[model samples]
Target: MQVASNFKVLFIAGFGPIVREPSESRELYCEVLGIPFKEESGGYLHTEALQGAKTFALWPLSQAAHSCFDSDSWPEDIPVPQAWLEFDGDSVEKATANLESRGYRILVRNKQEPWGQTVTRFLSPEGILVGVTFTPSMRKEK
Candidate 1:
């Protein structure tokens, strides 16, 4: 089925590998590759200031689980995602609603994160965790 024309995806906000090992992953992405990710609580490492088509990150699986299901573990029935992708829309709320109306299963709805982002999350058909987010801190200064 075709999605509605109004539900245009403005751009990809973030994309990266979801890792089980934070220290090793941090060594690769932050130390070795020098991606300049700031260390956050619970092994999550990310940077919103990266210059590219998408902000990159090395997110922990446990963190992903917490964000999607409010638990420390991914549900046994659901496939564990290998990666994640977040989209920035003109209006995150509208985008989320649009996706839901189209029969997408929203795992998290308009959840405000501690780092200051409002996000709605779901799993893609391929099991990648997807987020529709409005993160003011990530906005480039005009």
Candidate 2:
């Protein structure tokens, strides 16, 4: 008999809808970001596009932690996560410049990662951490 194996983690999901200094308004995910997310009848967003194998959703951080019980909870005083998105691109520098010009704050400049790939980071208006990277040299090895 063959047993089925569970799908391993494919991506990271950062829950949102948080109550913070600058609330991540629903429009950012629904319209501005153009994520095309699904929502419930009550108008709660179901999920956002991580654009990968891992599924990311939006929920109150406290409530989300409770749903995923048996783990350490988020500290009430600590800053909640800023969402992250990593991408494989041809020119990270160019992308970074374009994004920066568009008003996205550069969290980190385009630098070569220890893994030997070019990467850059930026923050969304809501303080979400987003990134873009390319591993062309590494991909060639494969």
Candidate 3:
């Protein structure tokens, strides 16, 4: 059997530090560290203002569940993730198709997120939420 080529992960698209206690978590990352975060009432802490090569976010578990499974609760079969990582890919569709062909269960595919990213998401063996994505806004000006 011919093996498929490895998916080309361009770079880190985003990093979400999963939080269970939003209020306390916000106090730390936002108040203590002085990370300018636009707090959401729904518990998603985010900012495009952070100066870095990689974007950072404070993601609530409930929000993650809604994004992945379209529900407020995580499926009992899949382990709850402590954090989420999105990897930039050349073609999210092709990468997603390859994963499916290799028997990986895709939770979401080619979903255009509200922030304008085309993503394919799944759970890693270690239970971390992972995504293969193409986010145009994250691209740097040449």
TM-score of 2: 0.45
Candidate 2 lDDT tens digits, 1-142? 3546775654445555443433354544444344566768855566655444232555464642332232357545434455544556577887777776656655567777666867676555565545567766545454
- Residues 23-136, candidate 1: write the lDDT tens digits: 655554454334577777886777887655556678999989988888999999887877787766557788777767767678899999998899998765555687878888
Each prediction's number of clashing residue pairs: 0, 0, 0
Q: Worst 10-residue stretch by lDDT in candidate 2? A: 63-72
Model 3 error, position 124 (Å):
1.0
TM-score of 1: 0.61
lDDT computed for candidate 2: 0.55
How would you encode candidate 3's per-residue C-alpha lDDT over 70-115 as one tens digit per residue?
Answer: 9999899888987777778678988787767756678998899999
Clashes of 1: 0
In candidate 3, which residue pairs clash?
Answer: none
Q: Between which residue pairs do clashes occur in model 2?
A: none
Candidate 2's C-alpha runs over 4 A off are 1-80, 137-142
lDDT of prediction 1? 0.74
